[model samples]
Target chain A: MNYQSTELQHQLAARFVVGSMRGLARRRFQRLMMDIPKLRDEVAFWEEHLHELTDTIPIQQPSERVWQRIQSRLGWVQSKTETTSKWPWFFGAFASLLLIVNLVMLIPADPVIAPSIERVAVIQSSEARTLWLIEQREQRLEVAAVGAIERLPNEDYQLWMLPVDGTPPISLGLLPQQGDVILDLGTRIDLAQVAALAVSREPLGGSPEPVPTGPVLYTTDLIRM
Target chain B: MTTPQTLERDLQQIALGDTAAFRRVYEATSAKLYSVSLTIVRRTDWAEEALQDTFIKVWHRAGDYTVAKGSVMSWLISMVRYRSIDLLRNRANQELSTDDFDEIPATDTLDSSLDSLADSKQLRVCMDELQPTTRQAIQLAFVYGLSHQEVSDHLREALGSVKSWIRRGLESLKRCLQR
Candidate 1:
């Protein structure tokens, strides 16, 4: 499906834009689009002509907040949290943060967190500042963003499982920024055989591929409870 | 109030990291993109997210644009439509809206910017060449983001027949439009 003749390419693109292609067929077409730029051009043609049908829908203005959010996400206009969370002086020392985390862990019990955890891992930058806290519960995992993560608005951080058997890493899921993200590691992963967890910066929905197509940003061993 | 050419230049400027050009592009297109978003997603919050994601993609990927992707408006609308459709599927609040466009042409109710939508207008002209049912099926799928099965069910035809009409309709439209 990578590159069909011009006529077939045009046909696939048309079915794609016309909304008749669905399920695996649709997903396959998209992969082909990614590999073949000329195919993308054909999609653009169908998109150009058929999308005009949307003209029937009357114009509806988005609220001003949409623009403001766009600007905020783009780091154009810093929101309140973004401005205050610059972490210039506070996050400069990783030792102090680890000391606090250790003291908190000794706080008689983490009842609120105990139920969902068999182990935990933290992804840290080269500067040793924590970016995501990874909690493993049975086959499920939770990722929480606590640091001032550095990334473009269009980029997403995906978590991966590196196997001790030296198999290719399995995608846990996209790392969360604002909300809670719990990824089911599924039955494919054996807990004892797990080597380390890694994170990578991927395009918006994480890497379109099973493996990391982007740079491997961080990796750390899982900690036993 | 800028022209399509102005928007194209704005995209070019945006690639160079000009914030003013970015805002100009957003201001010029957001309403139309929003309309397309709302139509497909059916929920305001989801539509807003779709709109937001589409713009973020545009701001990041404006450098990827070429004339081969069609007009700037087309490129932008394609992004909006694809994102909105994804949201619609993921959200699963799906139902085909009841509208048979056989007698009522899509172009008949265009907005004030019809002059600038030369591609759209030319498409409508070419769409006129399709069979009424074929034309109706294609319109429902593209305009409303209906799946092939959904289109088949909506048109009350067998799934196989609906798919053929859509494929045939698109082939005919492509040949006609390219002419």
Candidate 2:
């Protein structure tokens, strides 16, 4: 019960650094480590201690195709920007300025998209800032976020779709730290059975297991959109 | 041909935005990095994806590395590990199946061979001091990047107990290595 006990803290810190820390405890430990410089030191110590484990694995070369895929993905991201730039004439400076001005004016006068579904939810962090927007439209569910959140250099946040049926929550994807992200529910699960949207702090990318390793940071009812 | 040290110097130069150094750094580390990717991912396609991402990350985040952290190899390995883990975790979630969990190679064979080369006696000595359970827990978690739950399941031990073992094991190893 006494997590602060010297012996217990050392034990937990060591396990965490070596990667044996798991579940809610590991998540808590990670947050604690981030906040406490001493704890981070303990982690780095373990990392150095266990560095030799890497030697046990044979150095197998990844196939050339792996390199090709990375290049292509990077290329794709670059090309997307290029393609968007090509539309500048249609969405050129004057038109863009007008659209921005209109959006700014609409912010106060017009309500953001009203929920059409029976119930809609907006999940926000403890700081009361919007983190996710969940809405049901045309009997299909949708999740959206306005921007990627900035996170500590060493951490990541993951999105989850929880269902009211008490079944396991499905991972949506890694949350963007900046810029809006939209996910389509795509007639997969019954919209009525959906419960709430949840977010968990995870290793970069997301949790490896079906169950989340971190605590649920936010949860809110889905408003009808 | 550049030596590892020379390659590392070039990487440091690349970190300073020297394009020539970037090309050299890529040439030097790509094979080893690709090998690391293949071993963890087990899929050539995914490994390639990881390799590409790792380098791009290196290009962008090169300045983040500090010598105090460890060797260039260590820093780069950490990046690759994190990236590889991300890719593996994403793919695992998409598949919705646990059949293809990454496996750490058996240590006895790998260690014995490395012992023959014996480049770093300190590592071998430190490893020898660990209890089998502690050693196994650390190996599974660090080398394979298995979550604590996975390591517990793999070892068929209580999750709490596994955590303690790994933690204590790492502490003990650190003490030994530091000497």
Candidate 3:
């Protein structure tokens, strides 16, 4: 129970780095680290030893909304907008015109026949290898695999639509490992408000639960074409 | 990938209350941090929540970063990892929810950008020396933030043995790293 014992300090430091130190004992260790420079050094030393293990976790980019939220939380939006004030009013008008054009593109009945692919998203692996190409078609979603993906046994890649409200992702169905597979999404999803497209690794039959049950492998923003 | 020098410079500017510098820091590191959060939390929304909170802390504590504290990336990761561990422990106690706690498939690979770093390469070489079971246990605990009991459930080992493997594994890793 003594924090000053060298043997205890090393043991606690190791557990803390390995993350076995928890609950009240963990909280005690945190305070000890703050108050004792030697204890803090011991923890930092362990941190250096174990920290690089993080490198093995493939880097996944968070959604754009993360920065937006950070800006909102930090009250930086006003400063950001002021910095972008150099843009002319004509630029705003042009953006509005583009939005109108995209809205009109969404009005058609049969999207395959209509020249109205308003948005496209290329979902790539962590290596930046393109895995699936998603395009918003009128009244449906079109998906095609552009690169070779080796499917893991007993596992399927499932797609989900990330909404702006931060709700659990809505399943858009499984992604093809090779070639192209298109499903006719009967109801028109509001692409404008959709935050991003996420792909998760799931069981072969896809997620039985409403939310994805496996690790999210990749995420890409839908771009207005 | 953000070079350490650039990240350190940006952190310094962020400490001085530069929003643009803060944005640069976010742009450079959010993805890696998010990946970490997602792996532990296993949900997009929670991961985003943790990432948001981590960045907010980064914004406020940018001044606290020093060379003695370790790399900028390591500091950022520790903040998120601890927050995520808190979330995991809190949720586990609240409902005994086994909903999101699943063993990650072996095929799931991490970011390739990690391979380019010298530190990563050295760590990988050291990690590769660990027995597969020991390595997996450590990975589950460190990467997924699984507690010893959860790791035991996933690995099908006794609770005491899981703790031994992790403790021994870290000791082995410490020896290997020191060499």
Q: In terms of TM-score, which candidate is strongest?
A: 1
Give the C-alpha lDDT of model 3.
Answer: 0.70
Write model 2 residue lDDT over A19-103, tens digit each, in one string. Answer: 4444345556655665566676665555554554565556665555444433333332222112111111111122223333443
Give a tens-digit lDDT track for model 1, residues B47-161: 7877877777677678889987889999999888877876676556455545432322343232223334455477767866777778777767777777877777666789898
TM-scores for all predictions = 0.64, 0.57, 0.59
How accurate locally, in lDDT, is each candidate?
0.71, 0.58, 0.70
DockQ of each: 0.38, 0.28, 0.23
Instruction: State the displacement of the C-alpha of residue B33, model 1, in Å, after optimal TM-score superposition.
Output: 0.4
TM-score of chain A of each: 0.50, 0.42, 0.48
In model 3, state the lDDT of residue A52: 72
Instruction: Give the Å shift of residue B39 in candidate 3.
Output: 0.4
Best by lDDT: 1
Candidate 1 has a DockQ of 0.38
Model 1 clashing residue pairs (backbone): none
lDDT per residue as tens, model 1, A1-225 = 335588789888888887667644665567567657888888877777777777767798998877876675564564443221111111112322342364357335633322224577878889998787766667766565667777444577888889898999888778765323446566777777779988888886779998999999899998866
Q: What is the overall TM-score of model 1 with all chains considered together?
A: 0.64
- Give lDDT tens digits, candidate 2, residues B132-157: 77776676777666776777776668
lDDT of 3 by residue, A117-178 (tens): 55777787788876676766554555666566765645678888899998778888777664
Quote the lDDT for B29 in model 3.
83
Candidate 1 Cα deviation (angstroms), residue B95: 6.3
